[model samples]
Target: MAQIAVDSSPKKKNFLRSPYMLTIALLPIILAAWWLATTVTKSVPAILLPTPESVWIAFPRVLGADGFGDQVLRTLTEIAGGFALGASVGFFLGVLLSSSSRLRAAYLPFLSALEAIPTVILAPIIIAWIGFGIEGKILQAAIACFYAVFITTLSGLGLAEPNAVALMKSLRASKWQTMVKLRIPTALPVIFGGLQLGATTAIIGAIVSEFIGATGGLGYLMLRYRSSFDTAAYWVIIFLFLVIGLVVYLTIWYIEKRFVFWRRIEVTRPDLEKQ
Candidate 1:
């Protein structure tokens, strides 16, 4: 499946060049470098970076621990809630503003100012307002997500064919009909592009918000592990972050494949033996 994205050449391709194999190869290669540096050479101390074995053990320990699931659920909820809230608003507002030049001129600068501020900068303020609850993290995530989708929606709606729009107007189509039949379909690909980006952005926002102040969550757990010098546990959280980002990203990508199926173009590269 991974190879399908990378190997588009209409010729015999090296099996070793397959992305699936190359990606899997990263593990042993990294482990070997890590083992050599820490276990063999002692050049990198365990206190700063734990051995792979330690991290391997920590994964099971972390997963099997009581309440670990609760913390993970809290984090996931914050990310999902934030994304849902932000994306919904962004899509609606994008439609509204794009419907009129006056609306865009009236509100675009304010939105631009909000987008200028990073979610990290808002973390402390959000926590203070919401009192370290998951709500604050969700707000942070929402902030992180809003601009990407909004801009993409604007870009997409603007891309509707001029002739098609003129035809709609000539046919006395209502704004809603025009949007449903033409504008939204045109905008979906671009909007989904924003959504794909938001999948990971929401994670960063939630995690950083948790860092500011939180009772539980992966970010809080990492901070706790750091204070206690639990290096392996810290690494486990790092890996969890990576995993969460990838899962969300792939989910959005799959959904995009469905909704925007027309955008996909397969270029066949038949086996050289068959040729």
Candidate 2:
């Protein structure tokens, strides 16, 4: 009897044998490390780095504390408001700048300088001027969001081939029509790249602003925990930040993938991946 043959011509082998399972496995490894240092080995002091169990216990108490819900609501509101305001202004400014060489040259340097300023310093002054309320926090997030979106939008629109624009002009397409029908769609992927950066930057801006002077917010909670030396509660706040940042990042990533379905996107650094 003839034996069956199998074709195993070279194809892309996954970097890991069991990608999903391996990813999940890392969680246990991290947890074990935390447990070993805090519990078994007792190498890390509890006050500085509380045990995982203590953090877990602190979560409910923190969530149930008075005004906790309001604090969370305020932070979320600031993020939403700031992101929307900044992204919109950035997009329009990008369009205007892209249309005018003189304007782009005149203002881009100033924008870049603003972007270079540290959020910690920028936030405090903005908070003071805007009066230590939600307005300042929103403005802080907006500034961070604006620069990322502005830079990306400008680059993305410019990515449109010169020949493509000439071809549109040959067909007697007006500038507005050319933009709507040709440029915007071409720029989506790159614009979304800006938005992905904006998402996290917005969060950073809001939190940093809250740190300057605020009666409520996750940052305020974190400050209170620090003052009291409540390591477990502080860890809980840290975890909340991690979760929020991850959610915002993942949300942008998902949207990017959804809209740019024609091309594949990778979350991992492209430099590390094999060609």
Candidate 3:
């Protein structure tokens, strides 16, 4: 019998497979490309695309010296208030509509039509009615968030397995009990999807409202900087907006991971088997 040779080389880890690692790895490449484009090649004008160093310098100054903290706080307040109002109303309305086919048929089309209209167009009208205050901003954010949440939630509720629902009914389960124990769990992932989309939309809405007319906020700051041709400062403000949007999305994602554990299990099980 021939002796078999045993290979004992350790498996190399693949960092690129990790999402966080991939993001980290891409940052330097992106920065280098931006720097090269602006500085070396001059493909983009410095006025429009400021140097990365200039933008980096502007970041700390904006945070400390330029009162950007107050602007960020104000914008966050508007987003929080708007998201709360919109999500609560959307969830309840979705539940009501899902409970009745006739109601869904009557209202869903109208809701879709309203969603089709750009929310930014309403910014001027909202500002006109409510003035350049936080109220109008909140309203704008809420309107932007509402439809996505409502439609997604309605669809999620409708996805409940009919056989499972029938089984629950045969066991004499109360409507509320069935909803709480079965329908809600089934719909959570989809509802969370809507919430995630709504979160980003709410931020956009707030910023657009600020752009139209606002006493303060990042959008107002961005407009000010742009008007003054301070491209570096404008980029800093844009970075802050990106950070805020990321924070909102990640917060929603964390909540989903905590509550929607079943979905996580379902997704991970296949990957685990492959491993």
lDDT of each: 0.87, 0.86, 0.87
Instruction: Give the number of colliding residue pairs in candidate 3.
Output: 0
The candidate with the higher lDDT, 1 or 2, is 1
lDDT of 2 by residue, 136-186 (tens): 898999987898899889988887778889999999999888888788778
Q: Score residue 209 of candidate 2 by CA lDDT.
A: 87
Give the per-residue lDDT of model 1 (tens digit) for 107-178: 999998989888877888887787888888888898899888888998899988888999999999999999
What TM-score would you give candidate 1 relative to the actual structure?
0.88
**Model 2: pairs clashing at backbone N, Cα or C within 3 Å:** none
* Residues 141-180, model 3: lDDT tens digits: 9999988899888889877788889999999999888888
Better of 2 and 3 by TM-score: 3
| TM-score against native, each model | 0.88, 0.87, 0.89
Candidate 1 local lDDT, residue 175: 95
Q: After superposition, which runs of candidate 3 have C-alpha atoms over 4 Å from their true positions?
A: 1-17, 268-275
Worst 10 residues of 1 by lDDT: 264-273
